[model samples]
Target chain A: MTLKANEIKVGDTYSEEVCRNLSRTQIVQYAGASGDYNPVHTDQLYTSEIAGYPSVFAHGMLSMGMTGKMLTNYVGHGRLTSFGVRFTSQVFPGATLTATATVTGLREEGGENFVDLDVSTTDEDGTEVVKGTASARIDA
Target chain B: MAVDRFPIEAGHVMMFARSIGDADEIYYNEDYARSTEIGNIPAPPTFVQAGAQFDPDYFLRPRIGQEWFGSAKGPTGITQRSGSGGGSGGGGGGGGLHAEQHYVYHKQLKVGDVLSATTKPGKSWEKQGRRGGKLMFSESVTEYRDQAGELVVTATSVGVRTERPATSS
Candidate 1:
């Protein structure tokens, strides 16, 4: 589906309230599915005792997904072409994470419309958790 | 259950590609693959999972008592999945769902070149409830390197755990 100008415009922003905090059971489930089980995430003892983190943290990609959902929910379907992000900070369960995106670029070609968004996610204190850019093929 | 950072060879990619039945010329045909800008057979978008040790289903299904409602497909950016639920490589079903996945494109894996990937959860968190369900997010980072000590790829991914209200059917 193509996004109308009202759907997402440059400088447009949307904020979804943090609904659920992360947990070990979730990580273990992902590990079993994604084939990723590095102890740094699943083993609190390893993260605190061996890896040096106060507690097991969430995956950067996992956080990115939250950000991605924010963007996709706003833009709708069949309008996204490329999306990516970079991890800058660690996220622990129970923190209220706010995913935000700013529209930076937009254009339309013979047949396809292009919408570019600069995305940055932060925690309760405004810590940049993950920051990156995303490009979508919109209809507007 | 981190993706095994196994040394991937051309032969291995072929087998892996076959397992997914990608059947894309770029994944199997050398004569056709070399003709593209990628220069060689390329792995599918989901090929990153080649380094994994378990099926994608393990995370998609209800874990005994944990029944979560999710869309088959996630945000348009990138996606990754299932498998305590058993199936013979059935297509990773479609729904607007997003789970754990990380990608690090440090270098490209050319045809016949072997590479390995290692991954782990970087962090995790849970939210009370949104859209009538609780949400849990997990982040995992993946590192892909070759036997030659060269970094091939790096990715950090996230997952959303949203379980419907106990009263909802």
Candidate 2:
């Protein structure tokens, strides 16, 4: 169901626990699905010894993908007009993430109602991992 | 990356949605999607990134019969280093890292829509890092058009090449 423009005001927020204790297997699953099998995300020995990271980490896109779920669940199916994000920090295995979308503005254009959102996803330590904005169609 | 034929299939959509931890019925169940406002299984917002699967030359994926960079018997398979690992994370050898991604949806991307993508370089800039040395960032925009040649999605991606590996702080 689409969000009703009259029901939401600027500053309204929705949040979801996107993932908990992120696992290497889930990171590999994302790599397989997204076709970005970078060894830094899946190979432990390669990541530590070669890449010089403590361990395998999640793709920035994987964090963005999980955050998008919170947007679709808030806005409705097939309603997003635009979505963008910047990767702020690396997300490693065992980190829990929470995504939140805050309503920034609401307007009507060409007879279609729309809602603009400020999106942010943070790890268990409250460090922002992905940050950006999204706009979606809404019901008046 | 350019893809001549990127079919938005149901199984692929389901796998992508599941991988992202989304349980939305519209992403998987055909009958449920048929009743929704979208009227069909629609690709998740970030789904088009999967077009790399159709890109034959995507560097992140290990090509058959080629020496891969990841470890096999030792710390790495390749004997010679091409460049330094850079980017935010998930660096493929010395390739750039993904910094930002943006998408504008022209229409709902649904199952059965075969998309062709064409990418164009956007912009490039440099920045100084506190610990990772110099950061070189570049942008690329890809337009995904359906079989009928209608633009379905416009994706803009930014990649950063750090002078050295970015250590997690």
Candidate 3:
């Protein structure tokens, strides 16, 4: 359902535990679906010996995809007008993540209501992994 | 990356939604989707990134009869190594890493919509890094258009090439 403009305030916030103990299998699933089979995300041997990382890590887009679920759940299906984010930290396997969206502003344009939001996703340690802003259509 | 024919299929949407842990009925249930405001199963906000699947020259996917970069019988499949760093769309062969992604949706992308994408380089810059050495960042803008040639989504992707493999702090 769409958000009612009268029911939401500028400071309203929504959060979700996007993932817990992220798995290498899930990362592979994302790689298959997104068609980004970067060995750094799936091949532990290569990631450690060649890439020089402790282990394979999640694709930044996968984290963003999980975070987008929080936004679409908050704003309603197919209501987003814009969404953006920066990959602040790398997310590795077994990491747990939570995504939050905070309402920052509301406006009316061309007889339509819209909401602006500040979005952030953090790991178990509260390390911000992704941060950005989004805008979505709302019910007037 | 450029794709001449990227069909938004239901099976692909379901798999993508599931991969992201999204259980929304609208993403997979056709009957439920028909009753929604979008009137059909719509792609998730970040779904268009899958356009790489349709890009024949996408380097991330290992080509048949070609040497891959990931581990196989040994630590790596490729024999010779390049000194170049990694960036966006680069995985095993010392390519770049994805730094940032932004999207502006002109309309809801739904199942059955055929999309074509065209990408152009935007800008590039460099900066010294504390851990990964010099960081080279580049931007690319891609436009997705529907069968009618209507722009459906405009995406800007930034990729960073680190002088060395990034370490967790």
Steric collisions counted per model:
60, 0, 6
The residue-by-residue lDDT of candidate 2 on B16-96, one tens digit each, is 998999998888799999998888899999999999999999988889998888889997788765665322343547476
lDDT of 3 at A106: 98
Candidate 1 chain A TM-score vs. reference chain A? 0.86
What is the DockQ for all candidates, taken in turn?
A: 0.05, 0.65, 0.66
Model 3, B54-75: lDDT tens digits are 9999998999998887889997
Deviating ranges (above 4 Å) for candidate 3: B80-94
DockQ-sorted candidate list, best first: 3, 2, 1
Give the per-residue lDDT of model 3 (tens digit) for A1-140.
88999999988999999999999999999999999988899998888877778889999999999999999999998899999999999999999999999999999999999999999999999999999999999999
Candidates sorted by lDDT, descending order? 3, 2, 1
The global C-alpha lDDT for each of the candidates, from Candidate 1 onward, is: 0.54, 0.91, 0.92
Off by over 4 Å in 1: A6-8, B1-169
> B19 in model 3: Cα distance from truth in Å?
0.8
Q: Isolated chain A: TM-score per model?
A: 0.86, 0.98, 0.99
Q: Relative to the unseen true structure, what is the Cα RMSD of model 1? A: 15.6
Mind giving the per-residue lDDT tens digits that candidate 1 earns over A28-135? 554443344444445564344433446666655456655655665566432455567656666776756777778898887777787777778888778887787766
Q: Specify the poorest-scoring 10-residue window by lDDT in model 1 chain B.
A: B87-96
- TM-score, candidate 2, is 0.96
lDDT of 2 at B19: 94
